[model samples]
Target: MAALLLIATAALLAFRGAYADKVYPAVAVGDVPVGGLPRDAAETRLAERAAALAAQPLRFAAGDRTWTPTLADLGVSLDLEASLGAAYRVGREATAPDRLWSAANLVRNDRAVPFGLRLDLGVLGRWCDGIDAEFGREPRAAALVVEGATVSIEPEVDGIAVDREAVRAAAVAAVAAPSDGVAPLPIVTTPAAIRAADLAGARARVGAALAAPVAVVHEGRRWELAPEDLGRFVAPIVDPARTGADAVTLDLDQPALAAFLSERFAAEIEREPVDALLGWNEGPVVVEEGVDGRAIQAETFAREVTTAFFAPGGTVPVPVEIVKPAVDGTNLDQLGITTLLARGDSNYDGGSFDRDTNVEVGARLLNGTLVPPGGEFSFNGAIGEITADKGYVVSTVVQGERAGRDIGGGICQVSTTVFRAALLAGLPITEWWPHSYRILTYEHDGWGPGYDASILQPEGDPFGGGDLRFANPSDSWLLVESWTTGVHVVVNIYGPDLGYDAQFSETTFDGPFPHEEADLETVNPALPPGTIEQTEWPLDGSEASFTRDVYGPDGELLESRQFFTKFRGRGNVWQVSPDMVGQSPAGG
Candidate 1:
């Protein structure tokens, strides 16, 4: 009987030795048998079981609705390594005796351990956030506004959403608990951004601003702004970033109100300023009298008017600026103009009426014109273009060897007269050019030979050609006066006494007109083909020169200069028509 008992004990001892290095028999991991296996083998089996369980979609049931979470949709993955380790720990760890007892009991009775699971918390949070995006709603704030005679209020709404952190923790906890791996989003209550009670005072302030009229008074004139018009002028300035009622304030829209005022009274209140005229008494060219002018100050008036429009019956003065003449008689005397510095005259007797007309027009243009000290004078610019509109008639003029007609045929009479006046005044001559051909009118006026300076339209003569120009060399203002009487065109220059004396040489005859005749155009239809008509009698060529010696008040010679001139006679131009003469062009 003792041997029989010993055999039973040996059998149990062999069993314990066989399974000591392995899991006992009849041990299952989540219904999968893994008995009598090593730790690595048990870990492998539980790992496969965990992966299979995780592979199946986790089904969650909440409020009569069921949802299955996909592995990717969950934004998380199960950690089989950690979960398999937990499953492997059951019945495998403890004191040596306890492990031995557990292993021995597993031989007689099967021990089953459920599969464990671990969720990545970071992934769980992201998954919760994604869920909220589709299912969450924010609360709406309340507002009250008064428009016209009616009142309106925007209603309030409650928010329905889940807390991301709470959902994340709950998900991880469910998976870690190693139960049915399911978690529901934890919903929290939310409040509105604003309340209707905060806007109670806004309605009162808006009503007060529109019930009254604004009065504006300027220079015995009173204007009242209507309530409807006033309402458009005042608005509530709101700050978008600020919440609650204090963010809005009732105030005047200054720019809009100012614009409205301008449209109402701009034409009625506006006055144009006129420049004062210089009244001359005698030929000495003295200053007369001047008057001050006034203009509206636009920006300043707008600002003042805007302030008045906001106040209760506020009075705003008319904003204005005292406009003064650019050249007034009071300041004109400061220019130090006192006496006539020089005079030049020319005769236009037995000439065309157009000749008289051009001289008169040019005189009017230059009569009241002023030349500042050291300023250059341009004859063409002073008289502008001598078009027919300016009362100039086409008259006889010279083109090459041909005598023709031009718009300003005799305007050179005025130019030559002013040239002599400028020369005698001892002013600097910047530009001057002689006519293409000798003209008799200059000699007829006692200006003699080289004293002539001629101008033609677009005169292409070399070196500032065709234009008579000069400068006021003195350090004071110089006034030009010109006029025409019967057959005489006169030019006079007045300024502060420059104390200049001028002299000129006697005309030296350069000989009779050059005996040269060329083909010419017959401008006068009366002069037919083969008709050689002599328009100007031959005038002998001559030379002349002048010396200007300007002196100071004490008779000191301030400057000295000699101007020399030479004249080329055109002999006489004979219009031999195109039908008679063989065209042989030539120039002198």
Candidate 2:
């Protein structure tokens, strides 16, 4: 009995081992086969075999953070009954087109399993779900690799209909290279060889893109490149080592700078000194002068201008100045020359004078007029020319029909004072005349003296009467002060007040004495007949007198003198005609 039991036990163990081996085919990590067997049955056997070996735990991979399954872990099984049934009728009966049986037959007879089985080794991986191999590494990947490191690419192909051999070959290549660990591949550096084409392109770009000459500005000067100069274009390449910078500065073209500066900054005009403008009193000469018209030692007019605009170190674009003339004048006659106080006597030698009794008579008809130095004085023309429209009370004027006529009578006083003042000043006399007969009050001791009255002919007078005139010879202005109250006429002269006093006395000569009336005739006499309203005794060819004196500022007499003037006898006249002499005196 024991002998029989041992035989059966051995046989059973042997059968089980064989069955396990048959279902599990040898396969690499990545391999595929097309199906000839029933897919479900083939898959079942693969699972069964994989499960039977799964009892042994998977090996640990280096650098793996987790565990992975091996081929034996997934149990696999096969469908024997269907496989056999299909294989027997293969190529023998007219088969339904199924390659399963035909492929099984080949496996059985040729010992080549044409049947395909797919293994589902649930998340199959060497370790940590990654392929455990290496490839394409430098320095022979093995040099740097650790024993258990896996450094290879992993593929994810599933449910593929491919020949098993191709799958095996691909899987071998995928895991073939030795491990190189996690170190990055060393970079192979090699200087790029310069190609002829590359060199030519670089030269072309550099030549075309070079710049024109730079314009340098320094210290208010411009250094320019000469026209058509090739220096900027063909300048020698500076050695970067020597200069430490890319560009070289040609010392600003000094010759060129000097030439340009000469043109722009050259002085163009001479300068003048002083304002060429001077006052009119300074006269026509433009230059400065001494007290006696001598040229003063000073800068020329042009030099003054230069100092004003282009002095040393002056900036360019200097501004120019223009000159103008000046105006000037002064009053000089205002010193103290009284009207009638002349320094000496003045007289008109032999001349008959007419006289009027009216004090309101015009100075032109009463006496004379005066003007101070540089003084411009006017009269009568302003007081109305004899029209009676000027408030002038007409007085007597003798004539044939109008024995006593009235005319511009009393304007004489104004003219008289002016004449005396001008005379005393030694001013040059311009115009003068005398009255026809003697009138008192203008007479000295019953004798008319130095009396010359002007009957200002419309064309002759400058003042209310004929004027006495003068001008300021010095560089000063003349001021005449004139004032007249009802009884007196006053005039004063002021100026640089030339510190000198002057006075005057008058000397006059009378001509012709009076004669008695011999014959009498009447023809409507304008005056009452035989009536005499005597103003003065008519002298009949008698003597007249003249006196002279000089005075100081206080009106004190400096000198006094007397002289006699003889007047010619009056001519005979008759009031009757020759025809009337023959007729009776009263009743003839």
Task: Give the Cα lDDT of each candidate.
Answer: 0.63, 0.33
| Candidate 2 weakest ten by summed lDDT | 140-149
Give the residue spans of candidate 2 off by over 4 A. 1-384, 397-404, 444-448, 458-486, 491-537, 540-588
Q: What is the lDDT of residue 565 in candidate 2?
A: 39
Q: By how many angstroms RMSD does model 1 differ from the true structure? A: 15.1
lDDT of 2 at 580: 47
Runs of candidate 1 with Cα error greater than 4 angstroms are 1-280, 283-325, 398-402, 459-465, 513-517, 521-543, 554-559, 569-588
Give lDDT tens digits, candidate 2, residues 487-527. Answer: 44454433343332443334444445456433223332444
Q: What is the C-alpha lDDT profile of model 1 across 222-322, one tens digit per residue?
A: 77666567555555566657666766555656677666766776676755543333323553333434456655576676667545544445566767677
Clashing pairs in 1: none
Residue-level lDDT for 482 in candidate 2: 43
What does the lDDT come to for candidate 2?
A: 0.33
